[model samples]
Target: MKIVKSVLILILFLGIGATAWFYYPHYQIHKMKNDSMEVGKDLSRETYLDYYRQYSKQDIHHLAIGDSIIHGFGVDETENLVYKFSNQLGHEINKTVHYTNKGKNGMTSTGLNEMIKAGLLDEAIKTSDIITVNIGGNDVLKTAKKQDYYGAVKSFDTLQETFTKNLTEISMKIKEINPRATIVLLELYNPLPADHQFSDLADSLLPKWNVNIYEVAQQIPSSIVVQTTKVINSDNPQNLSQDGVHPNSAGYTAITTQILKQFSKEYRKEAV
Candidate 1:
């Protein structure tokens, strides 16, 4: 009994020490903000890759794929959303829930479709119990509307059709990869006011695009859609970055919070 107690105490100390070693530098880097590499210094890119390598050996659940939004544009930590959402799900389910963020900046559904066609989807979907995606923002915004009012108005219809087709293809590809994976697609956030007249057109079209996303999500049998339009459209000043395109730190936190809430619900149901 004494030997067992000694071993337990040693184990406890080791766990505490390991936790501090891994997280202390990361905590300090976040405090600075300008240098992400400094914030992530303790875990080098090699270490980050190593960690993922280790995680792949375990049972994976809760995978994510998308553009810079899931890549955490303003959030200091790359693992910020992925870790938080996974932990929430793991706790609620009383089972190990692993998350992988397969997010790339400036990627549209066209890029995602290409990745799927190229067989890159296996990295995310092969072992995932759930998969979440966000796309179509870039596809809708690819065409630069001239300052002229007529040009912008004329481009809207073409952009709308392209957006719909690309997203539909992305959704279909995801379904093809893993039929059993619980797929969820996060609708695109509203773009900031670019021009007086164009802003109005964007406002009108944003909701319509979100509606299309909802319609597409419903078409998949075991799928869900999480609408972020309201959160992004809120009057909170901290919600947008300086460029007004991506979410600011506060906005990213809000988005993470919403994802965690949904993950908790599904995870809890699985636990029962």
Candidate 2:
């Protein structure tokens, strides 16, 4: 009788703790929004275009797709890479350049392929000049069997195959939708090291994952692969985030600059 009672109490405590962990961060954000101390602080622009004024409503250039990176999960809305890319491309192209970002948290390459198959990519491809994809991190982040860390590391071959197939399929679908659209595939970056908590499990597998992204990018035409691993690793990524998983404003800025440089070079070449 006593053992049963203790087990129930332990389960209740764990459930409470998990709830707190999940909601506390969001609660803090809400509190900040309501707090009068932050009035007139100007965290971000009121409109997306305010931060990316180089593009006009009629002459927008591209569309951005992928997961949390494009979503600006850790950064303010105006400081996202999509806006930075647009601002830089506008300068290089000598025309108003706009980009529509369609990013979600925890999106994987498999999910992207599914979304395309479901016609989610149709509208964006039809109207956009260029498309940039930044998926694959979550696909690589999947564990093989809950606690089977070693097994996950060993399954890179399978993961790589799936990633390649998905990228190829997405490229083909986009071409079919709009043959003139150029696609830019952004490579994966690992913020975790061997010494990091998740590293003993994922470190060996991550480099292989990144390499697979590079290989897959080579197989697609009209696609430019941009690498930002060095920039993300320049500082301890863990320190750059409020949560250990997402990058903060500074990290987003660094990554935005790295990608903007690449887009500038590519746009210049295309213009000439």
Clashes (backbone N, CA, C under 3 Å), per candidate, total 1, 1
Candidate 2 C-alpha lDDT tens digits along 1-272: 99999999999999999777555644543343233122244544122223224334447668988899888887777777787777766765556777788999888899999999999779988998778888877766665445365665567678788987898888878877876666777766666654676653453444555555555544444455665665765255642576666667777767667666554433211111
Ten-residue stretch with the least lDDT total in model 2: 263-272
All models: lDDT? 0.62, 0.66
Among residues 3 or more apart in sequence or in different chains, the pairs in candidate 1 whose N, CA or C atoms overlap within 3 Å are 29-39
Candidate 2's TM-score: 0.68
Of the candidates shown, which would achieve the greatest TM-score relative to the real structure?
A: 2
Candidate 2 global lDDT: 0.66
Model 2 alpha-carbon miss at residue 27, Å:
47
Candidate 2 ranges beyond 4 A from true positions: 1-58, 197-204, 234-239, 264-272
As a whole number from 0 to 100, the lDDT of residue 101 in candidate 2 is 83
